[model samples]
Target: MDVNTTTGLSAASALTGVEVVERKGAGHPDTLADGVAEAISRAYSRYCLKEFGANLHHNTDKTSLLGGAADVRFGHGELTAPIQVLVNGRITAALGDHTIPVADIVTTAARDYLARALPLLDTPRWVDVRPRLTQASSPGAVNAPDTAEREASRQRWFAPRSLDDLAERHRMFSNDSSAGVAYWPLGIGEQLAVGIEAHLTGEAFRTEHPYYGTDIKVMVVRHGVRVQLTACVPQIARETPDLDTYIARRAQARNLIAELAGTIAPEHHVTVCVNTRDVDTRPELYLTATGSSIESGDEGVVGRGNRANGLISMFRPWSAEGVSGKNPVYHVGKLYNLAAAEAARRLHEETGLDCAVALVSQSGRDLTDPWQAIVQTSGPNAILASRARRVIADVMEDLGTLREQLLDGKLATA
Candidate 1:
């Protein structure tokens, strides 16, 4: 929550920027990364080629799926290019010789679809993919005990690649401490609400429902918006450079970023959504599924406890190798653009209001580079939940604003 400007309401009208870090490998999530890269390569080689173009001769996903996911972006020139997935025999674990990683395969396939998708978009090229294998378990608790901690001596620490800390800005916009734009609330038309449930308590905030998506609840209370988009972002990783046609399609989607950033504000709306269908795991890193919660640092969600899992590294954001990697930057930019487009569409269609909008989000944690210290974050599962939150918030706020404008213009007729 970084305050960029003050609104009429107060000095707290700050925009948000979101980021998250997820490790790879068995204990972490690199295994999943490997699968995604290889899957993307294979799919690109097969379908994306001979159709989109023919520059794709043979593809090799060199991405070590077991490593983890990198940064995520939403709105504006966040991304500059496409991703490169690398693959090899090492990254493929659960496969019984013929089976490919489910998430990886489909994700890459999805990229292929987006290549020629309806909205027509442009996507950067994902080049130089590399995949590797490891014998780690899954990423679990961040706070390791004695024996487990000792065993972790061999375990490497990775930081958040894409996530950022925005408590300040979020605080300002949330409570109207910063100046904000005016707000004209719309009736909670079964689409939005306000308030929140205590974390893990399942208690709705005084029945204050701000908005709801296919999954997760939302509310705008305490002078700010609270949302929970809780869908499992499939851990199944995927990428493709061979799929130039799909890349072209992705590129087509880039336009929406600007459209949205021009509208929405820092207050008055919140939304959450999720989809936890696919999960990519790495048992080798920390396969055990048992551990306790270990809290650490300020403004950072470090998963510490146990269960042979590597979990999201709380290390510095943007400091991780994979996070700074090129493919992730491309992917983050790609999704941000897609979400922006959706926001614009919603502004016009839902409320019939005319206004520009922008999305501001901040991941729960921060990315610390220069390793050295402890670790950091989430990609697929929790990642999707995070993204959905951002996407829904942007869309809902714009819609709400648009609706208000329409009512003013007597445009409320069916």
Candidate 2:
């Protein structure tokens, strides 16, 4: 419950020198890993709720994607080897005699997620999904009431050890401890970077530019009023008819992004470059069969991708916690990150001051009560500080609302 606030440089003022921001498109390998992990967790939670009336204890946060080799040519490409997708983690797999199809569910979730995220990737033909999930059941864990009664009718149920045991079981199955971090009121440069990236990946934009792949990367650097954006966008071989067409499309996309950046900050001079590594002299380009680097030996692991805000900012403080796939209820890693971001945004809105919020939570502690909560703002007024404290307190007190938002997919960590 400890809360503190102090005057400091705003996120925008702090960027007196070079400010850099990076965002990974949804189809990047690391993003793909995050997507699959979250998909499995959501799928598993839904299954558990329907079958057991509660979300079973599970953490599928160790998902990974190993890039595969491909022989990519102009307008065509062939996978030399299938991308190896490994979904690893633990989950409750049994309620008495009824065994849960954990592997089947996870694998299907992974495939479906990748298919949607990377539409050009032939998931069934180029992606090999391997489920390494293992059962996670405590010795004194109690089954759901319906499951217990069903087993009892079959003469296979066991009595609870004690009232304390039942309480402990309930607490253990309720949620996991995790933390989340967020910040708001993005600076002009950061906003431009994120906006441009989102615009390129947006469905409407992609529909017009069918060759544009999901594995897009946008990096923005701002020095004073000059903003530079470098985008690495892959083009699907099938959609792009030839090298010349790809070049034309890339130019069109770059110009569109530059125009969008100008709209984001009209005072800033903007420059946009797409696929800097491409060399037309050698006829080399950023081409892919699946529009993702996963088909070309770029490995991805959970937590290595974007943060809750969807962009990595070098000028901002960020936690190393990975929020996806963790239990949405009590996982401090996920909760604190989301809470921190919300706190910052709300504080800024109330006080009209740029703010940064950080929160820490201990294991087994109520998520609403954090070990420490810090709020820093560019404003030195005591009224702003007092308002920031009140905002933080209000956010911490409403943990249940945050939980619902998380479960409803309103908060994204990848």
Compose the digit string of candidate 1's lDDT tens values, residues 1-414: 221211122111222322122222111123224233323444543332233322111222233321111222111111123333334322222211233343455455434432322011132242223344332422443554652333212122111111111122122121111111111112221112211111111224212311110111222222233322222111101222123422332232222211221223234343333222212231111001110000000011111210011122121111111211112111222122223334434433544332222333233222111001110011121212233344345543443343233223222110
The number of the candidate with the highest lDDT is 2
TM-score of 2: 0.88
List model 2 lDDT by residue over 1-414, tens digit each: 676766664557344556788999888888888888888888887786688665655677788999999888776876788888888877766665567788788878888888898776678888899988665443434555665344222112122222222332344222333345566788877888778878888899889878788889989888978888899988888777787898898898888888898898888888898999999888888988878889999998988988878888888888887777876655677767887888888877777777778886766555566766777777665334467667777887787787666666666877
What is the C-alpha local distance difference test score of each model?
0.24, 0.75
> After best superposition, candidate 2 residue 213: deviation in angstroms?
0.8
- Give TM-scores for every candidate, taking all chains together and pairing residue i with residue i: 0.19, 0.88
